[model samples]
Target: MIESTTVLVVGGGATGTGIARDLSLRGVDVTLVDRDGLSSGTSGRSHGLLHSGARYAESDRVGAEECIEENTVLRSIAGECIRDTGGLFVQLEEDDPEYFEEKRAACEAIGIETALLDADEARERVPDLTPDVERAMWVPDGAIYPSRLGAANAADAEEHGGTIYPHAPLEAVSVVDGRITEATLGGTVERTIEPEHVVNAAGAWAGQVAALAGVEVTMAPSRGVMVSVAYDELDPVLNRCRDPADGDIVVPHADEAVLGTTSVPVSDPDDYEKAAWEVETSIEECAKLLPPVADAPTVREWWGVRPLYAPDEAEGDRRGISRGYFVLDHADDGVENVTSIVGGKLTTYRQMAETTADHVCESLGVDADCETATRKLPGADDADRLDELVDRYDGQGPTDKDVIAQ
Candidate 1:
């Protein structure tokens, strides 16, 4: 038997679930499917540091502004899914002082709250901080539990009458005459789906999904490693106040600290070289900021692929690619009813979904304003309930494996 929905959303990560919740709240019928489970892709494999916009303040002004705005909104609505641990961009003795000043000035210019802390003052906040830290700038950065966040969004969408299918992979898509007529989903929910609109939020695999519909989405995915070590003393997310490089950030958790990451682009997101150097280098660099993590006893390590969109020709260092999200209307490429949302950070998933939902709603002529920003997700305030939803949706991932029991 064939099924149908007003909207078919691919991928069950934060962004896909966010879109489902947004559209469902607006009286839209939505069906979301994931090849694996919620957050099983890039969303679930992150170091899970909630950005405070300070990291990108110097480089991308507009991206930083969007991050700060969404960071504030998530703190309000995400509840237990987020931790208000604050963030510190430390300038070590070996680091550039001018770069530190530049970031501080950029944050101030963009209205991102920040405070300059001397080495003595910074050590007072986090005693485990390296004494090599010459100074530090404090921002509103925090920690995020992606499993809980993804589950809450999925639960909210389900409450609003949206259908969610975990372990349901989109096997094929039928695009006829500039429109997507049908989509064939495999795995547990093997069936044919007729949809009025299709959203490809498949993260790193977005290019593959788009090709199923005969659309081209240039994705420049890079691999990064997150090493979680057994450390309980760190109180805030630590960012190296210099150029964006491997092991620049450390995200603290209940009994662990996640060290991340190295950027090396790959031709295929699914299959890439998992070099030992990536993991070794991340731990070595992160240990500079928090020296104790060097011997903290590694708990577990996982690699996450960044779902970066490169519409233009390939260039040097994939790190130069923008982390900003883009909502692509495939109609420009000949498919009218298919859209792809690509290249965004986990911190801005809600905004990414809001933008994609708005475009899809407009294309479908559904006159409805977005309510996701204001409406708190289901299970937002309850950790147990959120974990239960995570299990229900099979949303557990290595990013928060320690936080949420499988």
Candidate 2:
């Protein structure tokens, strides 16, 4: 038997779930499918930093602007999935001062609020910070629970009458007359879906999905590794003030701190290998920020492949590629009724979804303004109300972490 829906969304990460929720909220019949569980790919493995746009402020102005805008929106509507720990960009004695000035200028240009902190003030907030740190800049960065965020979007999508299918990998995409008519499911469960529209939100694997439809989409799949230390010394996110590079970010989570990541191009997203040297390098580099990290026990280590996209002729290292995303309408490539959204960071997932959904709605002649930007997600209501609840309970009630985890 074959099931039918108005839209079939492939991929179950944050972007995919965000798209599902947005479309369903607009009264569209949507079905979201994933090869594994929700957030089983890059979304689940991210370091979960809610970027304040400082990291890319100097290197990529557009990315920085998008991040800051999305950061404000997410914090307002997805408070339940984020911990407002703030963030700091520390510059050590050996780091370049001129670049720090440039970063500050860029932040200012992009409307990201930043406060310069002298070494003493920075150390006072994070005593574990290396004494060699010359100064720091404070931003509104925070830690997020990507899995919970994705789950919340999925829950809201389901509540709005959308169907979600996990562990359902696409086997074959049947296109007739330059349009997608049906898609077959493979793996443990077998089924078929026919939809008027198809959206590929497969993240790093989006290129592969487009190929299944007999079209080509070039994507640079870059792998990054992150290590989790058993100690939690910093309350705010720590970043080295400089251009984008590996081992420059450290995030404090529930009870531990996570140090990461290295960007290197890879051919196969699922076949890349994680080296021990990468793990050692991340620890050694992060230790420069927090001295205690040099000897801290590493409890876990993992890696995620970024679905980085560039034009076919674009050339450079993976890090040089823009963090911005693209929404491809296959009609331009002579194929109709299908679109693919790729690239961008977890911090801007909602905006990416809204943009893609707007295109989808336009194609289907459905007129609906996006409500996700203002609508409260499943567990996220009013930020002030949540804080009041926390204050009323204090040490006498379940912590915010416990509530979010549930």
Candidate 3:
């Protein structure tokens, strides 16, 4: 037997759920499916930093501006899913002072809001900070709990008459005359779905998913390791005030700090080398910023794959790739009814969804405005309720497993 829906969204990460919720709120019938569960992909495996735009202020002006705009929006609507712990870009004595100055100036130019702090002030704020901390710049960065965020979006989507199926993976797709007519899914949803429109929000696996429809969407995935260590006193997110490098970010949790990560290109997101050096290097580098983390016992470790889009299979370091997102209207690739959204950070997921939903609306000629920016996610103000939503949707991820209810 075959089921039908107005839209079938592939991938149940933050972007997928956000898109479903946005469209459903706009009165569109939607069905969302994931291979495992909500946020079981990159969304659930990130360092969980709510970007303040300061990280990219020095290099990508447009991306940084988008981040700050969305950052403020999420803080307003996400509620308990975010920790308003603020953030600091710490510069060590051995680090380049000119780079730190450039970042600070860039933040000011981009209106991200910043405050320069001396070594004494920095130490006072985070006493565990290394003695080499020459100075620091405080930004509005915070920690985000992706499990709650994804589950909340899914719950909101379902409430608006959308269907969500976890543990349902898209196994086959049939295209007829430049349109995806039906999709055969495996796992719990062992049947075929006839969707008027299909959205591939598969993140790192976007390229592979697009191929199923005879369309090409290039992806350059990279693996990074995040090691959560036992610690309790850190109050703010710590960032290395240098260029974007491995172990440059440390996100605080309830009783641990997630030290991360190293970027190494991989041909396939699912198959990659999980090297011990990456873990060792992350700890060694992050320990420079917070001395106590050097000896802190390791609680857990996991790896996440970045969904980096490569048009020409770009060369050089993978970190040079932009963190911005792309909403591909696959009509250009001869698949009119299918669209793929890829290559974005978790911080800007809602905006990514809004944009994709706008594109989908245009294709379907549905006149609806996106309200996700203003509509607070279901259970946004209650942590326990959010965790229940997570449990209901199986949206728990390693990044927030410690913070959320056990």
Candidate 4:
């Protein structure tokens, strides 16, 4: 099947979905295509943490502000996707207290609320936390539900005249006159698509997508492993209150706690092996904050890569690189008629989309302003009403209602 669209958005992860939703709401004819179902990539595997901008306080002030702003917007626009589980930055017996103080001060300066909670009070709120917890501070922003956000975006896009092509991987790219004209998808059911403008939002495999279009994108697909402890292990997001390094933060999902993430730089995004060592290391690291979790049963494990990027010509390892999205306008990069929104975090996906859509719209001569932000997405208001969709399917089980993140 061959199709044409005014704007073709590639990748169905957070960034891609956000762009599709924004462009579609602007009344543009948009088509979002992904190799697999939405969040089958990194966005699906991430610890559902709605960052309060504290993690980047010491290093990236700009990112911190952006995190706070987006966190607030998502709470409303994607309300069902988030819970105000109030995050707690725990200070261990040996960890530096000064760092905690600095984090608190920095977050407050940027209008991010932070309150010191005594160890007793902290344990009172979240009884599951280890009693040995020395101290903790409450950050007013933090929550989870990546799958909900992705679904909400897809629904919003559909409501505004957008199409999503899932399980449809791009196989080839055809260019004419230094511009992309057609794209092919592989599988038992093959397909093709032609678009006036294309946005490369592929996460880890972004490089491969760019190559298909005769352009080079140097993206380091660093794999990180996460473990899901099926327990209310922590009441709030438990941060180590230091530089982000290896399995430090434990994010709480619906009925489980997700302790992540060991960064292992990989050569391919398709590689998904949760190494025993990675799992062991994450448990060991999480124990540093709450020893009780050392005995908690791990219900599930997952691995996903962060799509870190650098210049196509230079290489400096993905770990040491800064954390932010890189929006490269193809015209400025000499790749004409294409733009790549690479890197960045789930928290800043909306901003990333707004930026990418601006560039894509410019190329297509579309004057639509971005509305992904400042607008409420579907299911953001109530999860129960959205649950009615399951009934729409003739009494399908809850799990069958939506193939979403658990």
Stretches of model 3 off by over 4 angstroms after superposition: none
Tens-digit lDDT track of model 4 for 1-406: 7888888888888789899999998888998877767766778767667888888876778888988888888876877777788888887777788888888888888888888888898788777676667788888657656666676787788789998776678888898888888888775338788888889999888889988877888887778877877666566788887667787988776667778878777778886666899999998898777676788888777777888886652344456666777888776555588988898888888988998888778777888788776788776777764444222211121211122333
Tell me each candidate's TM-score. 0.99, 0.93, 0.99, 0.91
Q: All models: lDDT?
A: 0.93, 0.85, 0.94, 0.77
RMSD in angstroms, all models? 0.9, 5.0, 0.8, 3.4
Q: How would you encode candidate 3's per-residue C-alpha lDDT over 1-406 as one tens digit per residue?
A: 7999999999999999999999999999999999989999999999999999999998999899989999999999999999999999999988999999999999999999999999999999999899999999999999999999999999999999999998999999999988999999999979999999999999999988999999999898888999999999999999999988989899999999999999998888888889999999999999999989989999999999999998876555799999999999999989899999999899999999999999999989999999999989999999889999999999989989899954
Better of 2 and 4 by lDDT: 2
Alpha-carbon error at 343 in model 3, in Å? 0.7
| Decoy 4 TM-score against native | 0.91
Model 4 score (lDDT): 0.77
Q: Tell me the spans in candidate 2 whose CA falls farther than 4 Å from its real position.
A: 313-316, 381-406
Q: Per-residue CA lDDT of candidate 2, range 293-361, in tens?
A: 878887778888888888663345778888899999999886799999999999999999999999999
lDDT of 1 by residue, 174-280 (tens): 88888889999899988999999999999999999999988899998999999999998989899999999988999998899999999998889889998999889
Against the true structure, whose lDDT is highest?
Answer: 3
**Runs with alpha carbons beyond 4 Å of true place in candidate 4:** 312-317, 384-406
